[model samples]
Target: MKNKEKIGFMCAYTPLALIDAAGYAPYRILPSEACEDRAGHLLHDNLCPNIKKILDRALAGDVPDLAGVVFVNSCDAMRRLADAWQHVRKDDRIIWIDLPSSIDAMAHAYVQGQVEQMGRTLLSWSGSPMDPMAVEKSITSFNRICAHLSELAPAFASGAIPGGYAAMQALYNKASTRDFTTTLEEIEPMPGKTPAPKHDAVPVYLFGNVLPDPKAFDMFESCGAMIADADFCTGSRLFSPVTGGQKDVYSRLTSHLMTKPQCARSFDPALPGEIAKTTLSRARAVNAAGVIGHVIKFCDPYLERLPGIREHFKKNNMPLLILEGDCTLRSMGQQRTRIEAFIEMLM
Candidate 1:
């Protein structure tokens, strides 16, 4: 590694937080606002939106400055992203973490194994031992971060902080904690600021995309709809409780990885049916009146399974609105109009 080169990892929210605590600048790569001219020649047209978006930004030099890249294989698109990057540019050192699909026994074991492997890799790259002090500090810092995020639920549920902006802020803080500690500290407050306005606000449960722009959720709020709950990778999955105190950092990290809610591609043999059921069940649990299905544009797994999800929501007498997103940007105006109309009809 170059003396001035900053080491960084690119993963979803959970690992991003953990890596941040480990003293590495981790960036969450979004998929929209892509620079087609730069990356168009490298990847195919049929690639997933998240992959396309990241590649586009990399080609355009929009990504954060870092010495290395860590790509987590949370989904197929991400795996292919690593492949495409390696083929196009072999100079950057890339580490790919093979994340499992669900929270099961097998997955848990796999996660534990992966954590050990990651520890070894970090040791080689950073030339620092994965000692007890570093591990404890990382766990403590992450716990503090999770506490801060939990405090934002009320603001997120309310109109104060747009979900997209809040989500992006979470990423920004995780990526640049060394640069923005005060901002994170400021946002960490109790959420009981006069329970989210119930003024004709339709309660909607968001599912699918992990971190969307706050503007999209703000659009829902404009229509008097409140996001009562979200099964997002960023919102819910990041708060994995530590197991058996600090000594078992390994188990805590692995267990959290295994149990978090996953995308449609992560569903088992049920072919979208299970995911729809899981989503609706979660929606009902949160007392949400309806569901908002946000799928990344050109994400084949999610795109091919929307119909089944719609039918499942219909059976629950719950209105489902599908919004097409590209991670980096939220430009679904037509869908926004439809969502407003649906909320109007439902309310």
Candidate 2:
């Protein structure tokens, strides 16, 4: 596995299966805890922390030797990050795909064409012949990981999993960087009977733009909160099952990602309160006492929708705690007091 080169993808919307079929390991470049002083000079400090932290990795050379990177412009910050990436890391192998903001048949077709181009580019770089059958096989294996995550999410949320959401985050962290087949095999035996609940812990549902540090979950545990469920960019949203389709593989992949549970970057006009409604429903499913919304500072997509979501929760008679941070452990540390207070209130 180490023999193969790695190609990084920044957005969860980017299909890793396509990269996998092209004979490279798909590396999801999740935001990490890092000092962004280097990246700060290249990009605006007011931009989303996820972007800053990610660019810091490139500037610091903290990443593996990536053959190339597939950038999907899911939001404005991501677009800026991609531009900054080239400046910090002089790589001509960067492929930027402008993700369609709306979900529709036309939009899906456009993205399908884009990912089709992406797939072709990756194949050329890998020196692999374009084989539709191989792509299909690769996607099938990757889809298994998605389905597995769908199942794991509920168990972890319901406290049926031994380590709760922190354990689930550990699983997600591996799935982000490791090979899919190995991840599936490793997780196949992971589920067991429910462990005893955290004694007197407040079960809270957490939703946010990005929380890549799994230790954040551990922090919640220490603060007297049990993560009843979570919907973060780095959490359950990582590996959504490609919804079934009879269309071509790329089209199927496009449709699923375009329509899955997403961050506030995209939305359906028909469902104005989709995110809040979904969060409420999922939290209720786990019988959570409250919801914690941790948004990255300057993340406009999530921030713009915050007030509306808060109102939705208020109307639903659910307790909501809103927190903002820079996507770092220090931010998580600052949040400890607030988190502890919230848990105390819930208890």
TM-score of each: 0.83, 0.93
Going through the candidates in order, what is the number of backbone clashes in each?
4, 0
lDDT of 2 at 233: 76
CA deviation > 4 Å runs, candidate 2: 153-164, 192-199
Q: TM-score of model 1 relative to the true fold?
A: 0.83
After TM-score superposition, the amount by which residue 28's alpha carbon in candidate 1 deviates from its true location, in angstroms, is: 1.3
The lDDT per prediction is 0.62, 0.81
Best by lDDT: 2
For every candidate structure, what is the RMSD over all alpha carbons to the true structure, in angstroms?
3.9, 2.1
- Per-residue lDDT of candidate 1, residues 172-207 (tens digit): 335332312443455554342435544357778888
Candidate 2 local lDDT, residue 60? 76
Per-residue accuracy of model 2 over 63-164 as CA lDDT, tens digit each: 888899988888988889888888877864888777776688888788888988988899889899998787788788887887777677657745677665
What stretches of model 1 exceed 4 Å from their correct place?
Answer: 1-10, 32-37, 102-106, 160-184, 189-198, 234-247, 268-272, 328-330
